[model samples]
Target: MDHDQINNQSRGAEGKDTKADGAAVAPQFSRDAVFPGEVVGEVTDLNRQDLEKQKAAQGSAHFHRLGWKRLTVVLIVEAIALGSLSLPAAFATLGMVPGVILCISLGLIAIYTSDVVGQVKLKFPHVSHYADAGQLMMGRFGYELVGAMFALQLTFLVSSHTLTGAIAFGNITNNGACSIVFAVVSAIILLILAIPPSFAEVAILGYIDFVSIILAIGITMIATGINKDSITTAPWSAWPQDGLTFAEAFIAITNIVFAYSFAICQFSFMDEMHTPSDYKKSIWALGLIEIFIYTLTGALIYAFVGQEVQSPALLSAGHTISKVAFGVGLPVIFISGSINTTVVGRYIHGRMYKDSIIRFINTKMGWITWLTLITVITVLAFIIAEAIPFFSELLSISSSLFISGFTFYFPAMMWFMLIREGSPFATHNLWKTALNGLCFVIGMIVLVCGTYASIVEIAHKFKTGAISSPFTCAALA
Candidate 1:
């Protein structure tokens, strides 16, 4: 079947049509399809303008704008943004050895799943977002469920970024303003930046963010190394007595996985690339660089700071240098997060404006609608950030609840569901079947176990004296 026919058939509201037997089936989208004006087919001249508009809306019309260099910078920034945030604390809590092992392991898993996403996208060019992928697998219902969950996941991630920004601001300002106020300030700033549509614009900020993340991490490492004496505790001492349980340990592991949490953005990134073929290379570059950085940063900081390492890690650096690190981090504090905000906005705008009369590019109403939607999302995320103000625990909850599925299971499921289409019992499909199935199962475990553990611990922190009331200035730094 051709692409449009597949989309039409999948728009049914109920379950997908199975064969006479019980096996699942997939849409007949080709994997190795090339660019526009290629051998895939021809476009009708009657609707040529509409087709171009559709291509622009879908992000393929601006392909050559983001070459391999720009995309690589974007991927690098995305991968390392949050990775530098919380991994040291994980290493501190889990002990250097186990924590490093888990960090590298999750990085490898991320690489494999990320590669899976690239493969799936190469096969199905229509999948510009996770929602599109779900639709291909299960029609309208699939798109609704996946889109909701995917948006929810990205929303929480944006909230996490906002919360982190609030903490960063609070750290610098020393509670001159309440954390809630800082969160709102950060949100408003993000709202303005996100108003201009298109990943191409954000990719420019991404280039700036790339430098910020690197400098921030590098300076933090230097300050920590030079002032190791200030940390009071030895670098590699087993802090079993600092009071962490196995559940908390697992939560730490999840946070490390959270550091590699850019999988959710891969489809959006690929969709905007000048040549989608360059994406696999970008994925490998991001995966390897992040693994090295996560391992090195986590081990080095935890070694020097020990249990003193904070979530942002900037806090535990030598006093003057901590300030410098935080200042350097300010770019990513807004822009890396703008990346998430941009992705979420694109998903919503794509859905609302795709086929509607309001989608007309020449209309002022379309621009107004787009700006209004982005503002609302940014505010809603701001509110959530203040409500769940605990930075580390919030990261844990977001990762366990959503990141596991997007970063691991969804890609695996996509591969398994589409690779063989309806041929479940084919001998040729057996090895792929086992691998994808196993990864899917692992994703589920991460979701279930990690969620339960994070929630329980977050509650315990609230009940005990460990955490303050939500929406407080309370020195979250």
Candidate 2:
């Protein structure tokens, strides 16, 4: 069937009544009345005509074009980037055993929570973003709270990309100019790339992004492996570093947590999917891909470079090859970063013009407002990146403060408030109840301990002058 027919069927399905917990009730239309092909065609055509008229009235912008494959690609574009490279440094602190365990286990939990996110989307088709889901759970206050959290998290992600991009440029050019100049360039590029407001449009770049990161990672791994014998004779440990402190350990764990934060944007991405229920496929595809890449990247790179492995990991591959790796990985860094801006832009723009055609962002006014909003977001991200010059610390603090809720506890609360069907003590509900409880506890621990760890580490770095002053021309590596 065509897009119109599929959308018509979706509308028909959604028209049916649902329970308070979002379970489907009896269908509104009789099956016999819609059974025949000709009748179905007529109904679909009428709905299609109505929709086309609405599209023309509103503008040509369309949101529901993403399929499962493309959705998977978008999730990959958002999820795996600097975080993948950061894993080796985390592994250096946590060692192979804990690192691998956290990588795989947290990945699985993220996948499960993302599945819950998808189910909530499927059930409540009106939830266009995470903030909308928050409203469903806690009214206007929750909406504003989650809205701020969502915006801040995405902004932090953009800041991370901005920082990574500056680092990439500095490494590629061997610090050819002021780092602040590079950061400004990065922000401008992010703003330009974020101009397109559609997730489906962004997914097209995800193809190139996927290839760029893979090639960069492969090059780093090979170069590191080749130079391994010459560099370090020390064997990589299976246990945590001997002097690892509580703060250090938690920061490492939070970095790993940061890597699995794909679930944070699932609702926003799914809002544009034509088949949101197929998000299971996307999450599984993304989750497994992330787990394999993160585990392998962290384990192999740390083993090659030992405890001295750097945050981006590419920097550990020797000077010349590290430059090559950064060049290869540049697309992933910017593209992934820009998508975060697009997401936040869409959210704020949609809210600002919810009852107006400007929400579609295809009109002249829509384009102007969209560009303005994204520019503001990019500038804010640049400021944040400059303020937090340390790489691992920024990621750790952001993950601890925001991602802990977005990836873990929020979804756990979602299960209790919106997704759960029956009593938790019921035979079939017991396991899921326990699982979600664990997720909530995990989120809380990350929020509290991870934040403490990040603050402590940052204070120590400041005290010892280990961190570079903001906007300095000093080399990031």
Which candidate comes out best when scored by TM-score? 2
> How much is the lDDT of residue 76 in candidate 1?
70
In angstroms, the error of model 1 at 300 is 1.0
Worst 10 residues of 2 by lDDT: 33-42
Task: For candidate 2, write residues 33-138 as lDDT tens digits.
Answer: 4333333224656555665467555553378889999999999999998668889989989989999999999999999999999989998999988999999999
lDDT of each: 0.75, 0.87
> For model 1, what is the error of residue 365's alpha carbon versus the real structure, in angstroms, after optimal superposition?
2.5
Poorest lDDT segment (10 consecutive residues) of candidate 1: 34-43
Give the per-residue lDDT digits (tens) of candidate 1, residues 1-477: 456864564465114535668665653433443334322232334345565566456544443366666777777755667447578888778887788788788888888888888788889987888888878888999889878887877777678778777777876776678777888878877777776566666778876888898899999888888888867375565544376786887778777877777788888778777688887777778888888988898888888787778877877886677778887898887787766777788788878888764543334676788778888888888777777546557767667877888888888888877755656557877776777777788789889889889888888987887876668766666
Candidate 1 residue-pair clash tally: 2
